[model samples]
Target: MAAANHNTVKYGIIGVGMMGREHLINLYHLRGEGVAVVAIADPHIPSQQLALELAQSFNWPLKIFSGHQELLNSGLCDVVIVSTPNMTHYQVLMDIINHPKPHHVLVEKPLCTTVAHCKEVVNAARKRPDILVQVGLEYRYMPPVAKLFEIVKEGSLGQVKMVAIREHRFPFLVKVNNWNRFNENTGGTLVEKCCHFFDLMRLFVGANPVRVMASGAIDVNHKNEIYDGRVPDIIDNAYVIVEFENGSRGMLDLCMFAEGSKNEQEISVVGEIGKGEAFVPESIVRFGTRVAGRDAVQTLKADDDRIKYDGLHHGSSYLEHLNFLSAIRTKGEKAPAVDLQDGLISVAMGVAAQLSIEKGRFVTIEETMAEHKF
Candidate 1:
């Protein structure tokens, strides 16, 4: 991608929380390189102050607003990045989509809190093809994962057989100050966080998931472990198995309460000819033969060979902004860094997995769709 021409693709960020601030910093760097962030909005006063400070500190002429509606109504931004809460995405998106100026939207992962809202967004986006509504599924932009996709597509790993992704984090114990904790608001653990992996699985297999089987329980984490003086429904850890249409399969293991020992967010794929594995925390890619006669694994430091940026961290949110600018400048023809339907499908997979866990049976994608029709 060439340098983003400043004439098009003016950027703005909404909800300046952790992720939103990261976007602001990324956009500051982009501004130094010709791209501009003309405006920003967040309900929190502290967030607004931070945005103003960033604009002043970086010598950028950016407007700050207290709410997303005000930001959209200002007509200052050509493109908007919705970094609001999961439950708030649908309404904010609707507001932007309905605006006369019609700015393109780059929404955060999971797209929305429910499958119905996801479908609504997709339908609305379809009606107005001019307004590009992209969902932020950043893992697809990861260099090692991108390389893995290339290898799989080029037959370096012939016919992917299975993929296993393990995500072990400290806990969801942190006070989110929003709807991330409650399942009704954030759509539970899978939809809130692990949807990235679900989407990645679909992309890696290059096929849609046929069915999902899952088993989960709230084994640990939380002061009030019991719901209403009994047991809670949400699971702290779970294992989900996804069967794809291409006769391939994927497995996801999530543990939000793995105290002590090394933490990891790892993904490994096995194919007929060879295997490719990536450990996100370690930033390593291991590839080796999986044949019956020759089985070996050789690891390489993926960080060393990554596409370097000026001031952007390896796994930061900056890459997505760069990709977004590229997409806008290049129109829709270029390879989508992240698209809307992909995000919707990812959330659907999570919803299906949760349903499978509750029902103790395999659930199809279609069944999930029918269950939550928009």
Candidate 2:
């Protein structure tokens, strides 16, 4: 393992798609804070064009590679961000880990398309403790979500009993390659889109999921359209119930066709002594404790600036990159907010829910892990 540049942490980006470009923009904002974008890898022409344009606009010298291997071999960066398609995460990450020179990685959410691959990534990451492998579960860094976590940490929410997260949003946007429309590639809608909620549930409840029951179908999105004579098989709506090992439970109500809904996402948690709720797109949180009286409720709002990031997601995207760079600068002393194990468990919960939906029965996380058997 090589030491990081004392004054600057160089970064390499793999897959210059939508998420990749968002990271580039965020990195551009952090140029003065000891962060530098040194290299990018993506074979897509539009992605290449955007990367080149961004580099030129910043007036920073950058190396371009058609694939991740060339960037890794170049040894131009101390860290790498893997934002490739979900199915490609495992290979990209493993490559980073196996590189002759140590390279820390920040891989996008779900880790990979299956539980086994996630476990493999986790194990490989564990072997090299000097290298940092952070997952892009950016929701935890969102201001409102961070406030909710702060409330939970305050111990007012004693022995959390239940958590509910609802997302009523437009159907999945078409990706550069339409990779998101198929379960084989995206690891099902639950794993691809709902993993953030599941990760939050695990954090609030302080336990891993024990059992899951789910039901859903392709109610609207892609039902009337065919891609090369095949209707998309991804589900558009779902209700998932998860039981945690600590006796707490979680529920997720997802509707992909509800683009006109007033709130895009609402999350609520109830514990023995207090309760908290958050409306994501609105950037507001309402919380109350039994000690404060039955009818008392307090409202909190994230800073107005938190919603200003140039993307559909919250401003936490920039914060996530900031935290990752800070962690690298500290040489593993300042740990990532979301580490590899946290990423893997979140994916496990989603995979379990998807399996439960298919089998029409309660599926245990243990069962899913056992079946994968990595």
Relative to the true structure, candidate 1 has a C-alpha RMSD (angstroms) of 3.4
**Model 2 misplaced regions, further than 4 Å:** 1-6, 291-294, 304-310, 372-374
**Estimated TM-score per prediction?**
0.89, 0.95
- Cα lDDT, all candidates: 0.77, 0.87
| TM-score, prediction 2 | 0.95
lDDT of 2 by residue, 1-374 (tens): 33345577888899999889888888888877867888999999898898889888988788999999999999888889999999999899998998888899999998988988988888888889879989999888777778888888888677799999999999998888687888989999999999999999998899899999999998878878677677778998999999998899999999999989888889898999999988887889889998996579889886435343545567788888878888887889999989988898899899998998888999889988875442
RMSD of 2: 2.1
lDDT of 1 by residue, 344-372 (tens): 89988999888888888998989877744
Error of 2 at 30 (Å): 1.2
